[model samples]
Each structure stands twice: as structure tokens, then as C-alpha cells.
Target: METPGNEERRPPTVPEGIPLLDEEAKLPQNERPELLIITGMSGAGRSRTAAALEDLDWYVVDNLPPRMLAALARMMTPGEGGVHRLAAVVDVRSREFFAELVSVLDQLRLQGTDYRIVFLDADDDVLVRRYESVRRPHPLQGDGRLLDGITEERQLLAHLRRRADVLIDTTDLSVHDLARKVREVVAGESDRPLRLTVVSFGFKYGLPLDADHVVDVRFLTNPYWVSELRHLTGTDEPVRDYVLGQRGATEFADRYVDALAPVLDGYIDELKPFVTIAVGCTGGKHRSVAMAEAIAQRLRDRGQSVRTLHRDLGRE
Candidate 1:
């Protein structure tokens, strides 16, 4: 919670150290839209991060040039087509132009713009493995080995990494996990509408990080142990029907969503940005997925935007 009088506190306003075009100076603005300058290693989950930000209702621009930061920020100002929050992904994909990014951000500060930087990184081995799994070349890789390029890229980003307001180590984070962390950090800034992420996970792979709250449905039923249902997914009608047929399934769903409604409503009313509810069962393929889909549908029926993910569903 913000301390009393916190809303009045503003970063010291500075005159635009750089000359601005007359048209730029006259652009209508609102409470400066929260600007997230996203830049990081290739295969470190930049795309996922941007998508997550978009899910939070942020206006996201991918592969944006550093020189365009000021213009983009001005264009995204509130009442400018109803844009409020903005996120931009700037990376080595910009090539040599990327070298100018720091100076561009410095200029923004001199102009008293309010913004934050989120740098996503992963362990070298992890990133290498990810690249291998995807069979994709790193943006920085040339004719030489990819690891060499990754090393050089890391060295180049060392300073920005230090200056980042939020540093996410994606080594152990799934795309959903990375998104959840970003949501949490963004949500902390103000009371704002939040996107609820409903993720289903298997106890075998552990809990999902995106989950702000967890509900264990292992107590509901073990479709995996049922010989007839072993190979079917929770989305199958039989599995869902069987699970819903349990003594407390319908009642539990009702009571749980009912209990969560007001709390979630309050959070949204306060403008909290995102909430995650994780449902877990013995295996992510069955019960948890069913419940998550049902809950997602229920929330959507109540006019909530929800992203549902079933982690471990396809894992061997």
C-alpha cells in the first residue's frame, strides 16, 4: 500500500535538455503512461515477456528502434487513441543501432519522462539449450559459433542489466512463470485493473510461479489412475463429466469462484494489474486442466479476461 501523500510524489521535473519540435511540445498528454523498455538476450523470453505485457493491457511494440523512443512515448500518451500503458522491445535485433539505446534513455531522463527498464536474462547453458531446442540462431550470431556471440552480447549488456529496475533470470522460468513475474512487478506500481492468469499444473513438475493462489484438485479425483481415462485429456467430455460428477465438484467450483469473486473484484477495482490462480492435480493433463478451463470460462462469463495455461500437459 502507498503511504499517505505518496500519490503527490513525482520525479523531479526537468526541462527537456534536448530541443523538441513544436508539434512534439504540443502533443496532448495525461498521467505519463508507464513505459516499459524491454531489452534482453535472444531466446531469453523477450517475445513472451512482451505478450504478457500486452495481456496486462499494455501497448507493446516489438523490435522498436531506440531513436524512436521519444516519438513512440508521445504517441502513446493518454487520449492519443486511448493508449495508456506502453511496452517496447529493443534488442540486438537492432544491430549496431542498439548501441545508441542507452543514450536515448538518458535523453528521456533529461526530459523528465517516467519509465522503467526490465532486462530478462538466462544462464548461458540454459539459453544455449533453449536455442538448441528451438533450432534457431541467436540475433547476434554470425558465421561463428553462437556461444561466442552470446558471450559478447552479455558483455555489451552488462551495464544495462545493472541499471534495469527489474532483472528476470529466465533460467528456471517457463514462459508463464516469466509472465507472472512481469505481472507482479507491473501490478505493484498502482491500483489498476489486473489480468487473471489461470494456470493448471501437475504436482509432478511442482507449482507454477504465475499462481498468486493455488488450489489443489488432487483431492477431487485421479483420472490418471482410472484405466479407461488414462490416455484422455481433461478436456475430454468423459473426464470433465466424471470429475464434475464428484460429490463436491460443482459445489466446490461454485464456492471457490464465489469466494474469489469479491477479492478479485476488489483488486481489479483498485487497478491492481494481474492475478494468477493455479489449479493442480496429480498430472496436469487431467483434473487440473479441466478445472482451469471451467474456472476460466466462469470468469470470462463474469466479464474478466483470462489466460489459461496447462503446464506439463504435453510433457512425457
Candidate 2:
């Protein structure tokens, strides 16, 4: 099958930065192996995305040549306690073998195999900065400038990018954000329920870039000001009581969770399994910690999956 970018013909525009799958993405339930092809620009967070999928219990193979994909897919056996979710990182690292990818993908579809392609991308400037920060040369750069390598790669990947089921733009995404995006794309593949992570952070330490929602608890009285609560963390009984005892603290927690009700429902409907809600205050040790716990508890009480992390707790 001829790819879209050949003969100077433009490919149909697909959705970008979201998991809007193509019509072909919906495979009939059968014995075919499930596969995810991870490809894109070298500095576009493919490695990190693969790591995140690994953490999600996916069987991840990094820098796999295009030819090996068929063999790997043949080995996958669904519901036999074997690797069912196979994620292969195929890219320019395969050199000339990479050009065989489009044909291989077409063959997979023709064979009725279930697979989806996720292409990661970033701005040229961001790609250049990433390579320079690591003091590494771009793979295709040879003796040319980094921009030359980026341009070469973009041209090489244009067709795949257009054909991808999910196109993630990592120009401004943090590692955690990228991981969350990965989760959003593959969440439906697993039986796990939606998981919410409530992070307690200090505003002074900077915002949590992966946060889906940020709540400020600075309006509450500072526990540090209270002589007895100064040395105790929010987990301590006295500190917890002190912070929640504030006039509007409990009300805020209840109302805030209520406000997030629709948003959480929307995430579940959209198959986004991971959510990070950050609670911030002057310092992470006191108000933020208490409020995060309160919010997490509310979520748990509603039978939603919840976990808590105190990011800046020990910083002070």
C-alpha cells in the first residue's frame, strides 16, 4: 500500500495531541495479538513514554527493528498469562530498516492483526535544546547542525505521523505529563479502574507540571504559626485537627470535590485512567498536606481510586 506522503500528495489530517483513534483502530475481538507501535522524533519523549508503558505492566521492547515486529507480534498470546499488551519502540535507530515500517504496518492490518501507532513529536527548537542539554548529537545529523538532523527526521517521519492513531506533542510536556498522556491513550486496554493521585506541594517549590487540577489552600491559617503544631506534620493528629479545624477548610474540601465531580466523570468516560490533583500552600508540610488528604479521602469515600503523595513535605 502506498503511504499518504508519497507523490507529493497530502495525507488526511488526523487529530493531534489526543487519543482520537482512526476507524481502523477498532479491531474485532479475536485471537490476533494486540500491538502498539511507538515511533517518532528521537528527542520527542519516546524513551520516556516506553518507560511509562513498562511501569503500566506493558511488555516493552525498545529500539526494535521494523522486521522483528511481525515475529514479536506472532509470539504474543492473549489471555494465556503471556504478554498480551506488546509495545514496540521502533524508530530511526533502526536506520535503513526503519523505512520498512510502513509496509510492515500495512501487512499487519492486512493480516487482521490488532495494532495502533503512537507518534511522538516536539517543536524543532525543543528537539534541538533536548539534544544540546544531553550534549549528544542527533542520530541523522552526521557532521551537519542539529537543525539539519531534525529537518531530516521530520521529513522521514511525516507519513507515519499522519498515519498515527495518537499524535503526542511533547514540546511543553514534562516527563510526568507525558506519562499521563500515555496512560490516557492505553487506559482502556487494562481492567484497572481510574486512579487519582493527590499531590501536596508548596507553591514556593513550583507547581506540579503534571497536575490535572490545582487547589490552593493558602487561605487557611498556617499551622507553622501555632506553637504546638509547628513541629508536627499534617499526618499527626494534632496538626490534622488544627488545619481541618480552620473555619472554611472542611467546607472547601467538600465543595472542591463536588466541583470536580463532573470532571472525574468525564475522565472515566474518556478512558483517562490517571489523574493528578495538586494541593498547594505556602509550605507543603501543613495546609497543603491536610487538604490533599481530605480531598483524597473524599474521593475514596466516593469509591474512586485514590493515592496521596507529599512532594514538598520533607523539603522544609
Candidate 3:
């Protein structure tokens, strides 16, 4: 549906007098360095997938309109300051443009662009349950039943699912597991460094079993039991000092860091994809939050890109 004279409607061949024309110039012309198309069901973990790709040095574009795929892909190529690896998220959220993705992808293929489609999926029940638990409406739902939106999305995405080079069923996989799969698929022929994430959660909500490493801080003091500090988080100076002041807290943290430092350092040396360190406490508000922050800072001091998430912090 492009206009006959639109700028994006240029001839397939690179025009004459383009200075950067070369063998490498033949690569996909992208606006960002790498272009990724990320799309999936509302609860199917697209955000997590995008985050993982971002961690792996992929330039991630989230919730992109499907109509913009071809243009975005062109912009992500070499001459356009596009990085070589790009990931984008497209989904039901793009109500009108979503239908154009397949055609755009076809155009890319015809143009010999190097791209991959990753489809993240989960069982219907799991997705429904996730939506219910999060209290968030499905993207395709518009004054209709939630399941109707889910059904419509499934139908809409059927073609993409069939065409996906990688299909991940996240019903049982932890975020770490999903991230590992993403790393494996997208880490081809690249020398970029892997990024590590440490996610901390409360055991009350259940440990983040997807964590590559799980540390228990329940052995530390339960700030929830303290009337004065009950409402404060581990981010608070008093809570942090109080936790560190515990008899075995410092020792435990030191030994834990020592144990992990070598492993993480080795992972970097081997160029492994990514590692998630999960820390748990009785409640997400106090101990786990403190431990996660402490460990994140420690890793940062060691010169690593680290992200910390307190999964259960704001949950009821």
C-alpha cells in the first residue's frame, strides 16, 4: 500500500553515488544497528524476551507498528547507523498495522535481508492465568471477553508462528530459561559480551526457579517482624545496615560473592550467554530487596552490567 513515490519505496538496488557502497553495504540497510521484530500474546513474555535481547547487545524496538517493519529494517542496516543485530516487538497492540507484518517480512526476504523471527508463546491457560493474575487487560480486548481477545490474537499470529525459526513455549520455562534460548538463537557469529541479570524475589510468592543461582536470605533478620521498619524496604539505609549488621549477614554475603565472582568471571571468559542470580527472602520488601541491591552493587563494582528486579515488591 505504499505510495508510488514514497521515499521508502526506493528501487531494490542501492542507488548510485551512495558513498558507503561496498560488499558490507549489501547487508540489510537498517535504521538501528540491529532490527528485531518482537511480537506475541499479551502474557507470552515479550517484555522479558525484549529485555534478554537488549542484554545481549541487540538494539530492541518494542511495540513497533507492523507497517514500519520494512522501513525500520532498512534503517537498522549498516549505512543508516543500524547495528548488525536488532530485535523488535510487534503484536496485537498494533491493531491496524499488525496485518501488514507478514507482507513486510516477505519484502525483507525478497530483498535478501538477514533477519529472524522469534515467537514466544505459552499455553492458553497459562496466558489466561497470567493475565488474570496481573489484572491487565489483553491487548486485543475491546469491550469484549478476555478470552475472545486471546482467541483473536492466536488466530492472527498463526502465520507468524508457522514461520518462526524459533518457537519458545514459556509455560514451564523460567525467565532465565527463556533468556538462554534467546541467547542461543541470536548469539550467532557475534563477539559481543553477554549480560548477566540477578532477579530477587520473596519465597512467600515462591522462588524464581528460573534463576541460574538462588540465594536464600531468610537466614537474616525478618524486618517484617519489626514494627518500626516493617514498611521500609531494603533500599532504605536503616534496613540495609540492619541486615548487614546481622551476625552472619556480612559473612554470608562475602562468601556468596566470593563463590559467584569466579563463576561469573569464568562465564565472561567463556563468552557464555547470560546468568541470572536469584535471591529470596521471606518478603520481597525487606531482605530479598536488600540482598538484590547489595549483590547488584557488588557486581557493578566488578564492572558488570547488572539489573535487579524485586518481582514481588509491588504485588499484593
Q: List model 2 lDDT by residue over 1-95, tens digit each.
A: 56676665445555644544576673346434568999999999999999878867789999999999889999897765778889999999899
TM-scores of all candidate predictions against the true structure:
0.54, 0.54, 0.53
Higher-TM-score candidate of 2 and 3: 2
lDDT of 1 by residue, 139-222 (tens): 778887889889989998999999999888899988766766776775352334458899988888988866789999888868
Candidate 2 off by > 4 Å: 1-32, 189-316
**Candidate number achieving the greatest TM-score relative to the actual structure:** 1
Candidate ordering by lDDT (highest first): 2, 1, 3
Better of 1 and 3 by TM-score: 1
| Candidate 3 lDDT by residue in tens digits, 1-316 | 6666664644355576455435555334333255556676678889998887777667788888877777777765455444667788988787888888888888888987767787888998999899999898998888998899899999999999988877888899777777766667654523444467878787878877678888888888798888988888888998888888889887777778778877876775454767888989876888888888888877787777788887888774
RMSD of each: 15.3, 15.4, 14.4
Error of 3 at 226 (Å): 50
The residue-level lDDT of candidate 2 at 144 comes to 96
Each model's lDDT: 0.83, 0.88, 0.78
lDDT of 1: 0.83
Q: What is the lDDT of candidate 2?
A: 0.88
